[model samples]
Each structure stands twice: as structure tokens, then as C-alpha cells.
Target: MMTVFDRRSLLRTASISGRAALAAPGLLRAQALDEIRIDWATYNPVSMLLRDKGWLEQEFQGDGTRITWLQSAGSNKALEFLNASAIDFGWTAGSAALVARVNGNPVKAIHSFSRPEWTALVTRADTDIGTVADLKGKSVAVTRGTDPHVFLIRALADAGLTERDLTPVLL
Candidate 1:
């Protein structure tokens, strides 16, 4: 699977922490950044494949660089890690990345993980819900600040509805 990269705050934190691998190549080249931190999520098969194959480790082995795997529960957690300087790279949806950027996270999208739409709205087969419009005034469980949340927002908007039309139970 392919992966997306979010370049963290290199200019702002590079001077103080010497941790700017994601910010730019020059900063990393200038410093002895021997470790790489990346997120791993079961929901993301691409990340899981990378972890399982150890391909990254193989490539960086000649440099004696270490690979650290951080498990991210969702895109929100991945963004949090990126902002907190806990990880150098993370996997997040395009929409979530946009939201993070708008919310003051100095990050740049560097790749596309996959072409698949990773989230959708669904209900039990027995439920009467059949379409996005049917979701109005309904309770939907979603992980806030992630792809699902963004997808829901866009879906609602496309259906001529707003978040106020339904109860969003944030997970």
C-alpha cells in the first residue's frame, strides 16, 4: 500500500529540538537524526504492510537508523502525535490533513496512501435508514477530527443538511 506524509514543524522546532526530518531534507542532513517515528494503524492496511514487511528498516539499516512504530487509533490521534512532536510521520486522510492545516498545524501533504474512499455511513440492516437524507435527526457515532467525521460533514452538506440536523456522538 502507498502512504501519505505530513511534514511537521521543521522550521519552528528544528532549532530547538534538532528534530526536523519531516520538515526538510537539509535539516535532517545537517543533524544526526538516527531514528524515524511512523504511525501504524490496523484500520490502515498500508501502514500495517509497511510495518510487517520491515522495508523501511531494511533501507535505513545501512545508516544505522532506528525505526519506531507508534500505534494510532485514528487520524485524530495521528494528527495529535504530529503536533506534539511525538512522531515524525503519520498516516491521515486528505480531509483530516486539511482540517489540521486549517487549525494551525504546520504540515504539508507529501503523498497519497491509496485511491480508496476509507470511510462511509452505514446502519443496521433492520434500520429504516437508507440514505444520507435519512440520517437527519439521527445519532451517528464518529471519531471526531478523522476521515469519518470529515466524510460525514461532506455527506451531510451534499445532502443539504448540516451537523445541527443530527446528533454527532464523538468517539
Candidate 2:
């Protein structure tokens, strides 16, 4: 004779399985928590704040996770770190992020950390070049393949011109 399982027994099994399913992702995350390396840049004051406070370290310490702070000289350095998998997270200018994506860097911009007006286009005081329009037909020194380059492009566009209109002296 076959023994029949009661409703309570089936309900108990289902409850236990449900509990295990609920706990699985947390356990997986705990196992995955080996280390996290994030960019630290004086340019990014929020990054400095996070690193100086040691908040991230404290939070992940109990899970045996290591936290590393790497200095980013600029958005270029941050992109390099992210591209090479040297860092899990890095801070970079929005334009740099766009460039990285366009070039198939396989990265994502996860945070809008700050709006600090960190960059500007300037000319020598003695120069007659006072505005974006003045840039036309002029030679401008720029680090090619960077945020400044993108900024220059935008400036040129705003002035109803393009790179073809200027002599871009790549540095």
C-alpha cells in the first residue's frame, strides 16, 4: 500500500523551499564579495570624502571583502582602470564616459556624483581670443581623445563651426 502525503507535509516542504530560495541570492552575494577597488581622485571631492571616512571599508569588512582605493589622475586614468578591470568603479567626466562607450569599453556610468564645474576653456590674457567664436581659424592645444577634446568639439559646434575650421594642435 502507498502512503499518502498530507496537506501539512506538502505545505511544510514548500515553506522550506521558499525560505531557501529567499536566502540564496544573499549567500551568493556574500560569496562573491571578494574585493572592490574604486577610484579615488582629489578632483572628485565625493570620492575623497568616501575614502577618507573609511565608510566603505567598514561596511564590507564583516563579509571579508577588501576595499582598494586607486588614484585617478583624470577621467582618462579612470577609464583605463575600468577598461582593464583594475577597478570595479571609477569617476570620470560625462563626456569621457560617452567616448568610452562609443569605443566599446563595455563600461557603464553608474553615478551622477557631483556637478562641480571642474573644467573650463581658457586663453592667455594677452590673446585676443575672448570667446568660442574667436577659436575659429586659431590653433588650440588639446589632449586628443579626452574630455577637453569633446568640450572643444561642443564649443566649435556652438560657434557654428567644426574641427575642420580650426587647427587642433594635439598634445
Q: How well does each candidate superpose onto the true structure, as a TM-score?
A: 0.76, 0.68
CA-RMSD of model 1: 6.8
lDDT of 2 by residue, 98-153 (tens): 87899888776544533435458898999999899998889988866776788788
Error of 2 at 133 (Å): 2.1
lDDT of candidate 1?
Answer: 0.76
Error of 1 at 92 (Å): 0.8
Best by lDDT: 1
Instruction: Return the lDDT, model 2, position 8.
Output: 52
- Estimate the overall C-alpha local distance difference test score of candidate 2: 0.73
Per-candidate local distance difference test: 0.76, 0.73
Candidate 1 lDDT tens digits, 58-162: 656776878899999878889899999998888888778888899999876665444756676889999999999999989999877776787889999999999
Provide C-alpha RMSD values for all models, in order: 6.8, 15.4
Candidate 2 — which pairs collide? none
TM-score of model 2 (CA atoms):
0.68
